[model samples]
Target: MIYFVYQILPHNCRSVRSILCSSLFLQKKGKKGAKAVEEEPVQVDAKDRIDFDSAKQKLQAVVDRFAKYANDAKLGKTSPKVFDNLMVQTDHGDQPYTSLAQTSIKGRNFIMTVYDPANIQRIINSVLGSGLNLNPVVDPSNKLTLKMPLPPITTELKNESVKELKNVYEKLRNGASLGKNHTLSSIRADARHKLTKNKKLDNLETEVWNEYEKLHKIYVSKLSEMIKAAETAIMK
Candidate 1:
């Protein structure tokens, strides 16, 4: 028995397909009483050849990150979730707020119960530095507990949040577009590499572009819808 392993990366989709076909060929040759044919042409299955799904999956990841930011980019209300994944500069390194402490909602305020009593000041400094205008107060006797008062929402603050939201949206949108183009270029290069050895694979490049365009439109539309929804939520 022979085995081949591939480490699937973002750009190696085509290479994996080729390897799978080769593996199938090997398996067929290994059967008892089977004869190995010289220079057998391995058929690349159409179902296996399409990589746009993977590309779209990667694109969705970018959009998802943006969506999280968008969700937190509002001035209307305060939730403990707003502090999720907030990177705090620590003596060791940068760490997420959730890693340092557990947060919960106490009426309109966000409460944090630190895991380490000594980390109280670190958590406090992080919340103060978050730019979310959360002024955290320590529970005098209970040093491990901290409470943050959610700022009162105002028209001016809402406008500022919306402005920041638009800025972040534009930046992420532009970056995603560039990333999409780069991925398309990489897929094109892979197609060309394979086509040079086999002209029968000429249609491979066309299929790649077609599939990419379809998925591209889907994700682009999704991002647009997200921004519009976010803006509406913030302004309302």
Candidate 2:
């Protein structure tokens, strides 16, 4: 048996009809005891030709069904084995079962193993809490990768440290402003007040520096965790 494969395109119905009609000529033989007659090409009528429109509709239906199956597989709504069976059924047993098995396996792996929605949402929440912007990059193979902006807390802490440092410098520079200069004893008291202010400012600056370092370490650790999660999710 011969199988004829026809690819139909939009606005090419007339061309398809012509090609089909021209290729379907019927030959006639002479009487059994007599010599064979010369062959003549016969014209096939449009009504006698295969109904391409009906075939196109059937093929389109199959395509739509396959797409639905693929989507279901991706969403974890269908098992790989079930999806493979459906594909084979859609092709009316024409396609080999093993030919589509690998595709189904990949689809299952991507949906069930690689991109776990719950895990992804957890990662998203962590990123958001860290005040970082999450950016996803999808490659040509439909695999997802992530990019994140530096955590806002890091910048905020650094800015706060700079502001505290400036305040401490200003206070030290204007030590005399902390005391009144009314008399010698008052001037001595002013000196004592300046000393106390200087010590307070020094402690405040040290605290700000320590807080900045702690925040920087936290930002680095959270970013590393997010990167590891993204790699695990998309690099199967």
Candidate 3:
């Protein structure tokens, strides 16, 4: 989900000013020989759940890294490549984006996706300007936050989309029964191609995606309710 439009800035010389400055000292010694120095990572607690305080600290560390001017000379304007160096991940895998900082030039949109799907949600939740980080607007994954508020779709529209997807799915079933080689990708691709060719397809694509999202949410909500009902029955 897209969040936070930021004004592009210039003059980023702050990279030189490294953090934890208090640890560094002026050790001017005789015959100063320089060798590589490996810094230690800031440690966190072994708690299972993430504490908000700890989350805030981690967020600050992220901000500090990207807090440089949007147009730093070292990091060319509109280049999200620099964040690749930073190893950001979630329990599942590396995050889709570390920090998605976007800037538009004139009219063309220059978007920077951090692709750190692992930590993507935490960062986006933090960036959304919300005081509290609720689970997620749409939890694509533990790391990825599909943060946009779900578009309000009429019941008719939802029904129609379900019908359409089912119809397409039926075609896939029919094709398979005929011994015509058909895979999920093949079916989806065929359906996608047809949808893409439609005159009002852009609108249709959004509605269709929304319908899928709604169905998924419904499944999860209903599944949980069913589980609770079953548990109660068992207890009785």
**lDDT top scorer:** 1
CA lDDT scores, all candidates in order: 0.69, 0.35, 0.37
Model 3: per-residue lDDT, tens digit, 16-129? Answer: 322332222434322243444557895532232223344334333322322232123122312334233333345655443343432222222223333444455554544343
TM-score of each: 0.55, 0.18, 0.17
Sort by lDDT, top down from the best: 1, 3, 2
Lowest-lDDT window of 10 residues in candidate 2? 21-30
Could you say which candidate leads in TM-score? 1
TM-score quality measure for candidate 1: 0.55
Please tell me which model should have the higher lDDT, number 2 or number 3: 3
lDDT of 2 by residue, 21-77 (tens): 222232222243255455688754423333334433433443343334333323232
Off by more than 4 A, model 2: 1-33, 46-50, 77-236
Candidate 1: where are CA atoms >4 Å away? 1-50, 75-99, 121-133, 140-142, 176-208
- lDDT-best of 1 and 2: 1
Q: Name the 10 consecutive residues with the lowest summed lDDT in model 3.
A: 69-78
Clashes of each: 0, 0, 12
Q: Candidates sorted by TM-score, descending order?
A: 1, 2, 3
